[model samples]
Target: MDKVEVVVAHAERATLRVGDVFLKVDADRTRLDAEVEAMSLAPVPTPRILWRKPTVLALAALAGTTLGRLGGPSTGSPAAWAAAGAAMRKLHDAPLPPRQGRAGRSVVALTAELDAECEALVTNGVLPADLVTRNRRVAEAALRPWTPAFTHGDLQIAHVFLDGDEVTGVIDWSEAGQGDALYDLATFTLGHEEHLDDVLAGYGADIDRDVIQAWWSLRSLLAVRWLAEHGFDPFAPGCEVDVLRSRM
Candidate 1:
């Protein structure tokens, strides 16, 4: 029998990998439902759903390794990065999933949320006050109106899989829904800004650089506390904190 390997564990959920199968256990049924639906609707490659229960989902493993890690450079070639961009464009162009719920926050609501999170960061001293303030101002550019598109919501590099120079699959779709397209681009390139040109080249579209930068700041700021609580050190070298510092 294959041993169960813990992939990740947090208060909200956990994932276990046994052989070629991944079992995702979550308390929130809605998120699981979203994941199932998004995978079905996506135009790009997604993991095969082996089976599903209310509290647990079993998925077949995809080929190849992850595109990159959060705190490290992607060893993938430029073509692989561009392939990921092309895949994202396909996903963005796909039809919206049915019964979309809480697609994303409104501009006013997002700004308010950023403000509250920033205050918490400063009060808790998770990040320096000046860094928090500067990033907060920088994040404002992303608060404007945007045309809704099918989005991965959490399109982190780690979620994308590549086989040599080709994108094989993209996983983790719980947060998928209609949202700003730029948010996906920003999230995918979060800590690895050097690959933006290659990604954009493959995406074959013009993108707002300022909006992408703003999202980089906003996402890092909003995520620090949650990551810390989840036993992830965003302050590690070449990690989220370094992403923020690069802006200064």
Candidate 2:
């Protein structure tokens, strides 16, 4: 596939070109014609960057706090972690149908996609065949009592920003759709488990720990599948199917 540079760089369906006057998107996914032209002068100049002063400062503070805590490259303070938990609680507990209750989902389809991905990785000498089967079984088990909730979908540290001891913003809204809160929690924990105690404390007692762990397992493996197939080396130490399978 002759991958388009802009498409590859940006995951979103739409984006503004370097010197273009209009926004472009996958025509199948979005109607480019429906979008209006920029309200700029002749050359259409680049889209004005939104001056998120507070947000930027918060992001800087978070970077400092996280780095201080990790003794290395980090994102932000425990404030961002707290904010993420609050955002999650609000999202999961929201009254909206897409976020509130369960959505119709097929375990079979999930399993098949997982298995196919595992098979692909194994074929490319990146995953073990036995571990792939084990992963399939674990995914099936986890799906048995699936309870979906509003999820951050991509709750990595980069999405977190801090202002003093509080979180100011969480950018990247592309994957904001509802799914499983646990899944989001797991991603948060896997990458930033150090703040779990604080995050959970703020989240309160109604949160389901078991469901969160199950979600953590399922979502991580699902993440592994994409990483493996797309040629992204697993970031977790010891990039092996067994490690991901264990999570499952």
Candidate 3:
């Protein structure tokens, strides 16, 4: 029998890889439905779905390695990064899924949430108050409205699979919906700002750098506590903490 390897496990969700089959188990049925539907709607490559039950979805593994991992430099070539960007551009340009929901928060709401989260971080000493405050201020610029586009709400580099310079597949679509396009760009390059140009070149369109930076700060700030609580260390070297510190 093939060994079952845990890819990611958290309170709300878990993913396991057993041989060539990947199993995703989530408590949220809606999210599972969204992932299945999003994969069907995405214009670019996606993992082959084998089957799905109420709480679990099975997918066939894609070829190649993930584009990058958090807390490490991507060994993927610049061309691979560009390919991911181009693929993302294709996704953004695709027609909105029929049942897509608004997946973005208002600037006012986000600002309020940021302030609250920052306060909690400081009060808990989860981060230095100065670091929390600085990133919180930096995140404010992203609160402005954006023209909606179909988005993979979470587009972390690890979700992108590459074979040399080609993007083989993009995974994890539970967060896919109508949202800010820059958010996807921002998420893809999180903690790896040096590769932003390659991605932008492939995107082949003008982008708001300020908004991308703001999202970086916003995302890092919002993720720290949740990550820590989930037994992941956001403050690890070259990870979310470094991303926030780079903004300082």
lDDT of each: 0.90, 0.47, 0.90
What clash count does candidate 1 reach?
A: 0
Error of 2 at 232 (Å): 3.7
Better of 2 and 3 by TM-score: 3
Residue 60 lDDT in candidate 3: 98
Write one digit per residue (lDDT tens) for candidate 2, span 1-248: 33323312233244433322223443333121111111111121122333222112111111222212211244545655666566557656654333221222456766676666767767876656676556555555446555665444566554445556555444333344446566666555653455776677656646666555555445555666566555545644533333455554
lDDT tens readout by residue for model 1, 3-94: 99999899999999999999999999989999999899899999999999998999999999987788986778889889999999998888
Ranked by TM-score, top first: 1, 3, 2
* Candidate 1 Cα errors over 4 Å, as ranges: 99-103
Model 3 is weakest, by summed lDDT over 10 consecutive residues, at 98-107
- The deviation in Å at residue 15 for candidate 2 is 8.2
Evaluated against the true structure, the overall lDDT of model 3 is: 0.90
| Candidate 3 TM-score, C-alpha based | 0.96
Off by over 4 Å in 3: 98-103
